[model samples]
Structure formats: structure tokens, C-alpha cells
Target: MNEQIVITFGNEKILTELKAAHPDRDLMMYQALSQPGEFMLLDHSGKDSVFKAPVFYDILSHSGEDKWDGFISFSTLDLNFDQQKVFDARINKLRTNGLPDGMHSIYSLNYHKDISQRIILGTWDDYADFELWKNSSDEFIPKEYRDSPNFYSHEAYYTPAKTKKTQ
Candidate 1:
């Protein structure tokens, strides 16, 4: 199945290097509003597209598969000491055990300025799937963290299509 992956860079220099190295793959870059020098490179083709780029292997701290033609959610949080440990442990469990039902993949990232801060980006096959996990009675995500102070939360639903370039 077609897959999507996001790889974040510490700064524009690294992103420029990646662009110079891999001209074949479609690499779309976005700057983070909250943190200067932070950038996110989105590759919707598949994991193989990312694996082929040597630069990705060098600087990527977090990378994961996303829904091919569904939706994506991104969030950033600043947690206390206890919350940080719990959050880390939960992320480790998810990574080791695999994603919860209806989820494609989730990535947990550390802020460049503050290591204690975290940013989570998740992709789901559909809106229903995303909601299922959020409102799950099983408590896939602990209640405390869910209600934590979220700095930002963004969601996008998209369908991939091919378009010819016009000169």
C-alpha cells in the first residue's frame, strides 16, 4: 500500500542538504511556527522513498508511516517531570507493541529548545478511526495526558492525486 512519512530536521541547513542530495523524491518542507530553525519534511510516496535518501538516516530523530489517503493529526505539549516519564513510557510501549487499532503510525518528537517538551504526530486511515482512539473506552491514551496543556493541535484530511506540471 502507498504510505506517507514525515522527517523533521533541526534546521534549514540540513533540509537544504537533503534537497540537494535527493532531487528525485518529492520533498515538501514546512517551517515550525513555534520554534525557529525547526522544519518538517513530508514525503507521501512511501517509506522506501525516505529510506533511499542517505541524508534522512543521518539527521532524523523521529520518523513513521502515515495514512496513504486519510488524515493526520499533530500536537505539541509541555509536560511536567512526572508527565514526561509517563509520556515517554507510553510512547515506548506503542512503538514496541505497534499502534493501537485504526492508527497507522505515531511519532513522538522532542523540542530543540526544551528537551522536556514533546510533539506528537499521528496518522489515521479515516476520521472515524482517529476519533475511535481518542474516545476509546479502553483508554489507549491516558486521560491525564489527553487533557494536558496542548500548545498546538492540527488535523488535515486529504486525498492524493496526480497532476501534470504546466509551464
Candidate 2:
């Protein structure tokens, strides 16, 4: 079944206000680990979801645990059909064999309004754990795959939103 996930970027104030306004909605917020003042709001409600900001995506599929703590990783990639096949295989292998330690959940989502692109979301135990997998992931992709002009990938890491108690 097709689901929808909204992505919004801003400071914590926006997220806090939105949460306060919609107390019952299941929303997950985060702050970019490397970028200050950058926050992300994730709304999984398939119905009348509210995203005040301009970023949102229609999720083709979502898997893994809904709980995310420690750190969150978001990545986007654009590839052609052949590249997608290989990409799918590699991702499937990882899922089938089990994700590496310290990685809690992994989600493969289609880019908003574009099936040719993909968005990967992962929850990690810490920055170190994410770095480890990222370094090794280069070896998993075929060398020829990198030569394709259609390949484009960008990944960012974020820490979960800090509550008033933690702040």
C-alpha cells in the first residue's frame, strides 16, 4: 500500500509549535547533526497531514521500526532503471542478511512524485556507527555503477529532536 511522509526543514521552534498544535498526531522531528538550525519534521499520517513547510514526499513503501533515537540518516539517490535493479538487490541483501550492528531501522522510499529517485532513511546508534557503515558501503556497489551519469546521491545525518528536559 502507498503511504505518505512529509519532510520539513527549519529550526526547532516550528516543530515545537506544530507539535503543540497537533498533540495527537504521530510526528517525528530531528535536527541535522552537521548543520545547525536545520530541523526535519516527519509526518506519517496518510490522511489529512499538516506540513507548514515546503518539503513533503509520497512514500511508496516504508519498513523497519518506527522508533528512532540516537541518530537518523537521510539519503536521496537518482538512478536509471538498470542502476535501480542493482541498488535494489544490494538493499535486499542487506535486509535479508540483517542490518549491521547499531543500525536500528532502514527505510527505502521513493522520491516525492518521482519513482526514478529513492530516499533512504536509517536510524543509527551513533555517529560512529553510521560512519562505519558508510565507509564500507562504497565497496558493496559495483565499480562500474559509479560511472553512470544518472547516479546522484546525497546523505545527511541528524540527531533526534531534543525535548525540553534534554535541552
Candidate 3:
């Protein structure tokens, strides 16, 4: 069976809170490699839990086609309009242009069971590739729309945290 996972992003205090609140849950935590106090926590068997913190947390599903790890990029986008077309176009471009150098795979996911909310999870060997991809901008979505109030994005990057739970 596939693992049902939920990912959470927050600071040290929130991480501690999560651990304390869900001690029995199988979790893997990642710390931001360059940014202190930032972390990403994954609950591998988290289908039943509802984490209601101000910090970001969402159910994650993947295509199950690629192996992903090392540097990670998690971007959450809140779109005012349906984004299926935009997402499809971006994936097609990646297939045509090939992934950025040192980047392994990228997955687009639905956020918190909301269709209008989307997440982009990217795995890379270096952070530069992520920066490049983010700055490259999507041609399918016009700059004005992306910059307007209709679109909002929050992103963070991390590496595996040194912890027994993660191991």
C-alpha cells in the first residue's frame, strides 16, 4: 500500500509541539539547510490526524514514479482560478525542456483537500537549480496574474534533519 503522508512547516517551537502532540505517529523531519529555525515534518502514516496550527500543514499525494530526496522545495500556492491548465502546461514544458541541472524530480500536489490550493514539491541536489526554476517564471501564466491578488505563494527549502525519527 502507498504511504499516506502529511507535511508540516514551522519553526523549532512548532516542531516540538508537533512531536509532543503526536508522539506515536511515524514522522520524518527536515531542517532548512541554510535557514536556521525552519523545518519540514512529514507524517508517513498521517491519514487520520488533523493538525490545526497556524503553521502550514497539508496532505500530500504523489505520482509514485520518481525517487526524490536531498534538497527539497515546498511551495504552496493559493489560486483564485482553476489551475489545471497552467499546471499541465508547466509539466509539459519540463518534459520537453528537461529538468533543471542537479534537479531530480518535481511533483505538483493538491493542498489540504482543496482543489484551488496547490503545492509544488521539488527534489534537488543543489539549491541553485530551485532558485533558477523559481525565477524562470511560467509562460503559461501571465506575469500580471501571477503578481496580482489572485495568486499567493509561500515557499521554503530544506534538507534532512539529523534525528532518529528521520532515520
Question: What's each prediction's TM-score?
Answer: 0.53, 0.84, 0.65
User: Candidate 1: global Cα-lDDT?
Assistant: 0.55
Residue 82 in model 2: lDDT: 77
Put down candidate 2 lDDT per residue, 46-155, tens digits, no spaces. Answer: 65667765465666444456556568887888878877787778777777777777888777778667877788777788889978887777634455656766567778
Query: For candidate 3, which ten residues in a row score worst on lDDT?
Result: 59-68
**Top lDDT hit:** 2
Of 2 and 3, which scores higher on TM-score? Answer: 2
What is the full ranking by lDDT, best candidate first? 2, 3, 1
* lDDT accuracy of residue 17 in candidate 3: 66
Tens-place lDDT digits, model 3, residues 12-62: 666766766777875557898668667777664636644654233353434
**Number of colliding residue pairs in each model:** 0, 0, 0
Spell out the clash pairs found in candidate 1: none
RMSD to the native, candidate 2? 2.8
Report the Cα lDDT for residue 133, model 2.
83
**CA lDDT, every prediction?**
0.55, 0.73, 0.64
Off by over 4 Å in 1: 1-23, 28-69, 137-141, 145-167
> Model 1, range 46-80, lDDT digits (tens) per residue?
55654333222211133356554445556555677
How many Å off is the CA of 56 in candidate 2? Answer: 3.2
